[model samples]
Target chain A: MKAKVIVKLKEGVLDPQGQAIQQLLAQRGYSQIADVRVGKLVEFELENVTPIEGEAMLAEIADKLLANPIIESYRIESQ
Target chain B: MSIAVITFPGSNCDRDCLHVLQNVIGAPARFVFHKETDLGDCTGVLVPGGFSYGDYLRAGALAKISPIMPAIHRFADAGGPVLGICNGFQILCEVGLLPGALMLNRNLRFISRWVDLRVENSDTLFTRHLWQDQIVRMPIAHAEGNFTVEPETIAKIVAKQQIVFKYAGPVREDSPDGNPNGSTLSIAGIVNEAGNVMGMMPHPDRASEAILGSTDGIPIFRAFAEAAQEKSRLEYSY
Candidate 1:
């Protein structure tokens, strides 16, 4: 089974890299872009687990490893 | 006094820290690998910088979960001083030894240069020898040295005098030339509530020698050595 974790900076935290991308795109004439919040996506394969167990285990792993509770949040999805 | 510099897999500045502590400061300094569960006879620990775990997951995330962290945490809990520099600072905050988090520079650039810092509170064990508001030059080389915390936490830190250093230049907070990473209130370094742990972005070890362009960093190492020696003496005497 495969899993994907989407890690995002928690709201209210400044996303400098995301802001830079927004500025760069605006300068390149992509005027409609309102904002960009940069984040990370991690993918991995789990061994011999059903989707239900994978979901539960991934949630725990995300809280403990994939995301820092202080600055980031994570969403785990089956891929 | 004996100090240990904890070396993670990618810690590039461990040797610089050891050199300063052992050769420049005249304290016995040694390395403690990340996998070691014991800090040995070390009275103080220095978390030096590099791309620990290649800055994967987060700048210091992987290193925070290393086997050595629990030992360091216990050491700090027992009132042992722990100094974290650059990536080490990130790890300290990640592990909750210190409050706040370091974010990417607002300009999204890897900053590597010297900047003047104003000593905020000189009453702590780390800065007791330095006078408050004194300006010191230190080199900061980091991409994620921008510090942030909740407004409430910031207020409490200020009230409790946990802030130790700030940028010193015209319009300190707004001037990129001063606040190199756009840190909150120009904060460059801070101590924990217990005053036993400190996390700072500047590389003091890099600036400890005159040949490296400044001796401003020497006072920091000296202060740590002095504190460690005093603590050890007190323990042995009792």
Candidate 2:
């Protein structure tokens, strides 16, 4: 089983990098840019793990390693 | 009065914080590496500023996931006093210990200079020694220090008096030209919901000694020490 984690700044949190990119695009003559927000994606491969087990393990990872939980929120999905 | 300053990779102000606590304030302070999970017997933890993890990914993105952060969360949960300065503040926000996020400077530039900050609330452990509406000069250095939060949350923060510090004078009130990073609400520092943890963009440790051109930062640290001592005495009396 492979799990993917998508982490992003929670809504209402300012994203400086995204704002910078938007400005650069506008300066380059791309005037239609509406907004940009940057996020991180992490993919992990787990073998012989059930969905329940994977969720429990992923929660631990979120708590200890993956997300800061303060400014960023994360979602996990298996494919 | 045992204080511990957490040192992450690229943390330049760790020594400054330790020096202020140990030498200037005469408190027992130690440097705790980012890998150490145990905070030992320290009553207060200082997360000093600097480009932790080289400010890669985000200002405090990588450093927020450090091994010691779990311990930090535990420390805050136990009602221990924690102060996050500059990049340390960013990290605290990144780790969800504090509210809001630090965005890029509204001017789109790196800011490195001294600015005036008005103490908004003097009731916090980090500000109890200072008078309300007092102004102090402190240095801020960062590419991303703009604080942003939802309007509704901002109202709640104001209603709860969680705002600890704000950019003061015309320089901070007049946004864009006056504000360094275009922080929403001109907020520079704020305490957590519990009021025990604080994260601020200004470097108070840098202002602690007279040799640094100002001793205004003394009261902030002294407040922490006093609060910690008072808490300890209460714990022992029980």
lDDT of 2: 0.83
Chain B, per-candidate TM-score? 0.94, 0.93
Q: Per-residue lDDT for B157 in model 2?
A: 86
Question: What tens-digit string does per-residue lDDT give for candidate 2 at B1-238?
Answer: 4777999999999999888887888877789899998777777788989999998767887887788888888878878888999999999888878887787787778988888888899998899889999998888888889988767778888999999989874454435345678887889999998999999998888898888888888999888777665565234211
Candidate 1 residues A1-79, lDDT tens each? 9989999999998898888889999999998999999899989799989999999998987886778887888888796
Query: Model 1: chain B TM-score vs. truth?
Result: 0.94
Candidate 2 regions off by >4 Å? Answer: A1-28, A32-79, B169-177, B233-238
Lowest summed lDDT across 10 adjacent residues in model 1 chain B is found at: B229-238
Cα deviation at B221, candidate 1, in Å, is 0.7
Among these predictions, the greatest DockQ belongs to: 1
**Considering summed lDDT, which 10 consecutive residues are worst modelled in model 2 chain B?**
B229-238
Question: Which lDDT values do the candidates have, in the order given?
Answer: 0.88, 0.83
Model 1, range B79-193, lDDT digits (tens) per residue? 8888999999999998899999888887778988888889999998888878889998888899999998988899999999999999776444446467778899989999999
